[model samples]
Target chain A: MSVDAKERPLTPATEPFAEPLAELDRQRARALQMGGAEKLAKRKAEGTLNARERLDHLLDAGTFKESGLLARSARPEARAKTPADGKVAGFGKIDGRWVGIVSNDFTVMGASSAAINGKKMKHIKDVSTQRGMPLVFLGESTGARMPDRMGAIGRSILGQDRYEYRRMRETPWVTAQLGDCYGSSTWYACMADYVVMRKGATMAVASSRVTSLAISQPVDKEDLGGWKLHTAISGLVDVAVDTDQQALDLAKKFLSYLPSHSNQAPPTYPVPEGSDEPIKDILKLVPESRTQVYDMRRVIKTIADKDSVFELKPGFGRAVVTALARLDGRTVGFIGNNPMFKGGAVDPDGCAKVTGFLVLCDSFNIPIVMLVDVPGFLIGIEGERRGAPGKIINWMNALALCTVPKISVILRKSYGQAYLNMGGGRNSDEVALWPTADLGFMDPRTGVNVVYGIREEDDPALFKQKVEELSRDTSAWDLAVLYEAQEVLDPRDTRQYLIDMIEVHRLRMTNCVGEHLMRTWPTSFG
Target chain B: MAEVKVASEITGSVWKIVANIGDKVVEEDTLIILESMKMEIPILAPEAGTVKEIRVKEGEPISEGDVAVILEK
Candidate 1:
């Protein structure tokens, strides 16, 4: 490694570091290159993809051009060791659109950030922002390097970069929580526009080790920062997937729905081959029996353009479903209830999930389709303890504020306050119900009990007779008679109905904003 | 004692009242709500209730949980 001493100024130069820095850069790159390969093999053995591999999956083939390839720590002792500071920074294209990327390799000193690595990150961020390219961070790190960032020198490294520090609305940023994402990874994820996490990955403000020592309590990885906790309770992450490949695919799919940068509209892609599926089969997808639970996901996949239902928070909030799917190759947000869990009743987590999704959809001008089959909010002591009522209200508030085209389809039961929350009445622009929909404040059986205090067991004949009488007035026909729902149609017509509704509102208003709540929603906790 | 009248939010028939005369109650506690379509409606206490009288029997049809009356002190 050649050190150009002549270019080294006695005082720190305000200008960019010169070729004297090249020796440090080369050493860092070599260190990372050597450590990265070993680490990659080890990770592959464990059935996980390394950060760089995940980045490759995210970008177009052969399009990556890395920057700061040789950057390393400026500290004399640290500079003599630790190359590339275990981070690979670069720019690449995903489907022809430019994106800046950085993937931390945990094998090199545990992928800890050093002075030069920080500078490299800041530089990449600056370039991406200035050029209006999306920034993607494949984060898998152990926070800052202790040796490099421990004293005054470390504090200097910690000093903020004036150019990239300001989060002016310039470009979109994405972060993938691949593995143990701590410190800088956590920070970047929190600040990103979109964040995707692998199912088994851990993301925390600090690693379990640091947290355990500091707090004097042992913490498990999942307990410290699990996918379920973030997606369900915190609402910090946007999506959690089963595999690294899914995470990468989601990153690509998410970017497809977003513009290359804030100033431009999301690039529209030609509908992929066989993307359109017949709408006729959608009816059979939903079972005829209300008591029988069917996979709502199948219903979503059928309605959306084939292969376009990119689900977010799929494992969390099992009751409420949210996804960004393409309809005729245009991105829209779809929120529905899954009867598979708690009979499609919205619990606190489900409510929070839908609330965030609604905010994102409204902010991004993504039209919404709410498929209703709610049996009201989940009721129980557990529900109360979770502050279910508050979350439900929050959901309602978000729904009320949304100005984009909103459509509602009553798939089955639309009971109680849940009816209003699911875009019933005037909550949506178009409200349609399936023929099987039973709209009422409560089910007939429950209604009979509340009114008469009669157990059928007490007087079976009378109780049966009374239930029959109450059922007469509580059907979909009753709701339609009062104009509560506009139309009740066969389930087969849902696709055509939604397509026509979207077309009607396509030009109704212009949504040109660069950032939506989904993009701005925090990906990490403090 | 104040009168504890259980009114249903929606018009439905009572399924059953788990509470009876002289049953102590708390706020928002479910006395009984009538079931109409397929929902388990809870008729909660307007105030804590001590069953003063049972207005209607289990088999009779009633709107809301107005079948039993309670007194609160």
Candidate 2:
């Protein structure tokens, strides 16, 4: 028993309650010890914070109100050894907004899953969902507890909850993958709308050790589930950071732009004191020669509010840049193609990134701004193997379902289906292009070569003449004569055009967040 | 010393050679310009290094992932 519990005097009416209350206090103290002081010290030695320390860093000061504080492992032998049943869950303040958090205590049997911990997590998950409060999961577990969750008794876990994976998106959900995240940890990480993983952490359905044992060959942890896999290939994690503090800070930063629930408008910030960066700079950043590659981030930074751009999954989709930014203090989802990577072609990774970003924006009522300078969809044997066509269709499907205001500015080349996917024609609220925009199905040289079967070496003069003839079809004047594209503004006028477009569409706001069509969409690719 | 592999980002015919074997180049220095869509697309050196190998000759067709130059740092 704790020092305080044994000292309290027992009255005749309260005599029966005295022993039980002392027992409760003793259990709570043991639970707080986690795997004991030695293990906690070891965690600190590795520069990793323990369970409660993570919550302290994540939530505002002294706001954490823990639930199931006295929870013990259901397996009788494991009760004292598994305090909080290897999990710590509670309600707390994130930027003063109520949120529920579940942090796994890795000191206890590698924070393996047990029935008591599952119940604790389920309680917070349900309560957070019902109240429309954001829930954050700090995962560092090693799959299901083998002893308790096996055989006939294990079947009870599936029947414990009927409403599984039903996310109404009433409130935003965030997850942080800190260390060895297997099984349920991986599932919840994928279910979160925004997930951040730390470097050197592994997140997979099964651990490398188990896979090695099953296959009779050693498996590298990184090969199974590393930050690079999720960021560049699987498209599961949104951001990868270097520290636990950075991961926690990112989750808090994401929630700042959102409302406590879907019923309210996304929060707006005070416009920083400045006119948009000299619009003339945009022309300088974009290449006059259509074939040249230039950094598109320069243009994005100039147009968006100063220092407000936060890029997500940057390393994954090298060709396309999906980011969150403020335009005149209003939160907006920003997508732009970087020609520096693969000549601004939409690769499979780019397609997957854009699709998820569009869904997120549409669900939260954030307007989209696209800086389009696409060549076309990437073509190769690799593209086919990566399922590029299906991803392209998914991206188009998402674009069609988006009800938020979309404004696109075609900087230069906008060719093939890429133009349609980037909010051309009836897909967007407004579509405008620069005077130098090249709108066509394909490049002029390729068209001439395909039509006339003439190579530059075969007949240079004839090929030049045919190329010039085809180039005329791609000019902005051709589209302007048809009145298909909106006013062709000077590249410098793009920033003003976008700012005015956002204001022009604001009057159409119905005031409340929509019945978010993508509320229950898979947060990450399964 | 680490060797940097200079891979082409797009498929095109090499139009001009701006750097040769043993040439010292700085990051972003255009080593070769490819002709695509009748436009000049330069393949720049990714980091400062001495050109150790000229992997692809002028007028050679190169696609994405095809290494055109190798630099010794």
Docking quality of model 1: it rates as: incorrect
TM-score for candidate 1, residues paired by index: 0.74
Model 2: DockQ score: 0.37
- Please give the fraction of native interface contacts (Cα pairs under 8 Å between A and B) kept by each candidate: 0.00, 0.40
Q: Give the candidate number with the greatest TM-score.
A: 2
* Model 1 per-residue lDDT tens digits across residues A1-526: 1233345543344546645465554454465463646666888898887756776788888787877656666766665445566788888899888898898877777778777788789888888988989889888889988877888867876766765445554676788888898988988887775789898899998889899999998989898898878775666788788898998887877888876665554565566666546566776677776655556778888888878887877756677798888877777789988765545777777887788677656655678999888878877677788888887887887788776788999988888999999999888888887878887677667777888998878888888887788767656678788887777777777877888888787633344442343344433221
Evaluated at residue A276, the lDDT of candidate 1 is 48
Q: Evaluate model 2: give its TM-score.
A: 0.89
Please, what are the lDDT tens digits per residue for candidate 1 over residues B1-73? 5675554433446666766777887765656544443444455565565767656555456642244555565
Clashes of 2: 0
Runs of candidate 2 exceeding 4 Å displacement: A1-25, A278-280, A507-509, B1-10, B13-59, B67-73
